[model samples]
Target: MTLDALRLEVPDILQEDAASLADLNEQLAEARLQPQEHALQQVLSLLFRLNRSAMTLLERQRALQSFSEEYRHYAAAYCAGVAPPILFVRFCAEIATGFKRLLLQILQGRQPSRPHLAWCLYMAQHFLAQSLLRHYQLYQEPPASLWRDSHLLYWLGEHQECLDEPVAAAFQPQPANTLRGLYQQMLLLALSNPFHLAEGESPLLFSALAPLASLARLLPWDVDDDAEGQTVDLTESQPCLAYDQAPEGDSHYLRRFELGALLVALHEPAPLQSALERQLLERVRHHWLGRQQRRHARSDHAGDCSLVVGLTAIHAQLLEHRPGHCAAQMLDTSPGGARLLCHADQGRLLPVGQLVLLLSSSATPTLALVRWRHLNVEGLHLGLRYLKGLPRPVWLRRAPSAQTHPGVLQSTPVQGGGWHHGLWLPNEQFVEEENLWLQLPNVHNQAALPLPAPNLATPLVARHPLKLA
Candidate 1:
């Protein structure tokens, strides 16, 4: 690709290394006689270089995809002592940090430190996270997956076990699976090593360590959000939830975390929560919502459960779940019904207006907001008509963007036009979705994305996913 191409559409997508990547693969094939110890190291280096170049090529998505296998394998081996993974991890973790910083500089439009140099460092460590995190479970191997076992991770801390309470009225509980615990783990470990690039320290020397530093920040998954259903206006009588539901924790905790990150410390890590704690809290909310659901037994009323999640610690959602149709008895007894069509899409996202329109789905178009469910009421409603979809909402898709790259935990940013998980470090651009970067015609504002035509499947470049511990 031409240099202008790099500056233009996919500034980070580096394809020049294709032949080199292929050459390394060939070398791996022929190194059959090499000692397993040396072979493993060589294999990883080659894979890392390939991945790094992908980042350079704006093939972050592909690089990440390619790196997953090597990433996990080496990680599993290192933690398990099957290989010298600890020292290796430490090395990579140190380097990863620099790459992350470079991403930030690029987003900020500051001159890139060792331009075209970071692609290698970041990818090498990133793939390591992919390879290792899966086996993070193996590191604490036992009866089953860590997803079901709290004993999978436990440490004896000298300090108090309870979290340091905030200095304010605690906010409501977050949805269900904030995935904070998993995210934090990624952050702390990836940055496992930190160096003081002091006065005498060379920029090249520090730059060389970026990939390792970045490793500490490799996040495996986005925050656990339920598939979005349709978003709802708080004023409405009821609101629909993200089909999957939302993460759990103190609503205030998440709110505080977001508030802290937005304007100040973008590199800092948030808090953590456990499934056991989240589950217990959900039970409490079920009681509070005055709705109970049995495992096997169908509820006389579906989804009577309610919960709240906020966007930017300000956009609050008090979502409730109920039967798709009216109460069972009412559905069977009611005779005639009305038909209406509701617009699935919302009009312009009016910043200030509390617009609630339920495009009726029967025969004619209609807009209706929820009113009190009086005992005298009569009607049959199929699905809900909320203003928007839930976070972790089903079909959670990032809208098309103009350009893209690999950085941070790769969370879908929770902004509009799509979900914003992570931010673009180069320009300080925080895109809700990966494609958003590709949607921008110009990467100048750091707000717009270069998107392909809506009909075509936008090119998804491999983004090195960062796991923020």
Candidate 2:
């Protein structure tokens, strides 16, 4: 499909590149030998395309299941020590790739049934947490994105299950530092009923109201919340709930009548009950308002620097071929979102509301929602809201800008290339998700580079530095 034909319209309707993706999937399925690395990437690219397509929920589930099963087999073999190293590596990478695509879909507000969502979530957790994590410590140059992304996926699965079932955990009163923690806290804030905290609320009320907990999960802080059904505004005469005789169309109302009734009973209550209710409301307010305010917070860094940002489909684009990375100029970043400038060609294709992965040296790759786009004299400016995560603390310095090359684990590139003056060093600690670097020092003296013993030496690359030359 032509690139211009790939523009993502609001209320996303992605153009399917089904023929090419199907062909790639067919090739992958039929391959008997250990497929090449490019083939693995092709499969991942195809999976991305499929998720972006306008497939029905069942169709998407079936297709995803088929791909998940295929990779699981490879993972099983790799764990068994039978699969080739290349195949195993590809399996690990593809699992991360698939999970990211799944998350982007979720960010787009694609609602699948609980069972189907559970199945997909289960597969993702199995691949990333249960399988890939076991081998994560072994890689010398792992993708830093994996550490944070995996945690997010794990929490999403856990959250999906716990929304209806007994919550396996409670909200800690502590501030959340990570994206996973923030989401975990949000789930608890949104789904936990404050009235249930009373010691003797009565087993009868809890038992009768159990089902409502499943269907009426409410986010009291949401902006679209009905004014009449707001929790804080509940009264004895006008409880914040749709009555039993309410119209069928009002059934989806966010107000939980059962919970609201209990809230009214405890509204003027014993100190303990009042305190618990206050605490719940405080958390809800904090997170809700925090989300809005963080989006526009100030940043100290320059907004026009070249930041290494990863890009997936911001909605869906018809690419003749998938590009390795997106070149985006960092415009501005707040705790909640970022503004980026990109070439018109790339920016025009991204649809507002689509999620994309933005990677940088300062922080792990973030899943961000496209909120707005505009063309001006400067370029195509895109606004992105970070999804369910906060950026790293502002005080922590971002790594300085430098050229980087991705290398295979435990291996180094050959010498004689650009930036040879700097040694290939592993992180002070062996972090499986951070990449090894070929750093160039300002001194430019070859003798200053750390030359480890042969056994410890990494592969070196030999390319002339164009500017230096």
Candidate 3:
């Protein structure tokens, strides 16, 4: 029963500068980018593990510093027009990896610690993404390979833990559907559900489309529009519109149910790349550079909001579907109660209302509620909660029925979007330090501060890359 409600006080946090970010945005966009191929790729996988490894303070600091500096040099070179296209892609990937590393530090730290450094890493990640979209044109062909790693799927939940500090405890018992289900559904969606598409050849392509259908259905709509958790004129009901300017002049109504964020934070970035790239890029710049310039742009206040995204893992666990379960493990259900799955690949059975922590960390060991929804030939649906929306600004998805059961272990990949609004705590709530979070409000939480703004230009002064040899 670790899925207890966590209360996060919406802090009147320092906002990332929008204009300065735009400047860096331009630099990152124009830089040529290329995908990682050799040593760098293997190293990236290693770094993610090193992120949570037991290392000395100096070792940890140096690791983060070196990682960040690499991106800076990449950026500096991009500005000088020397980096390659694939390098640009590597740069973005590295930066994202770097941010993920920093974010882990923040989560692993004691609660109530200065988070300025963590915030800076957050901003850097933002800027790096700016460069990513500017150069890649993600949607044309998303760097699918970038997020193929299941373990590194999307450390979105970490970001959620930071943003929704207080209200992070577990919520209504429900299973976290996770990207595995989405991908599985995507793989089989077209074949099983014809209404979603006409005909498709690519299996993964169909798997990719399933989530949009899921998002379309998650909207807080009045009409059933055919509630079987499927079938809806998604674009018609909520009608994709910018945050600041509402489509029908009811912009205020648009903010309800934390809609803008969930899609941006938890869903795929490729789909929204075309539409939200600009805003997202702007936000990234602000996070890293803390600068903004005003220019008349079209609708869609894309940037300038917080975000959380959930991506599928390139490597996934094998779950077999059968009886209660093909094997004998746990099950998970979608928010809409349509899909179900288990932790083990060989599909298994569930005892009952089983509550378990999704992402258990040495720092912030948080749990999620799970339940057995259905056992079709596809998979088991474990009702989930906690992931809908963190802290506050809960999503309008139907809450799982109040139920409880034994416990187990599991993890889900996720990412969040939207920083513009939520249950924000006024400035009075925090004890500040160059804009970071600290535990006890008055104590020093060393882990919260970022190692430093990385300057990749600082040659690998040490022989061992991450350490001062």
Among all candidates shown, the one with the greatest lDDT:
2
CA lDDT of every candidate: 0.26, 0.39, 0.29
Question: What lDDT tens digits, residue by residue, belong to model 1 across residues 210-284?
Answer: 222222221122345332112221111111123244534332212111111211222233234334323322332
* lDDT by residue for model 2 (425-466), tens: 222322323332232223332211122322221111111111
Model 3 TM-score relative to the real fold: 0.25
lDDT of 3 at 224: 24
Q: TM-score for every candidate vs. truth?
A: 0.22, 0.28, 0.25
Q: Report the alpha-carbon TM-score of model 1 versus the true structure.
A: 0.22
Best by TM-score: 2
Per TM-score, what order, best first?
A: 2, 3, 1
Q: Could you tell me the TM-score of candidate 2?
A: 0.28
Alpha-carbon runs more than 4 Å astray in model 1: 1-19, 28-33, 47-60, 76-87, 90-179, 186-469
> For model 2, what is the error of residue 142's alpha carbon versus the real structure, in angstroms, after optimal superposition?
4.4
Q: For model 2, how many clashes?
A: 10
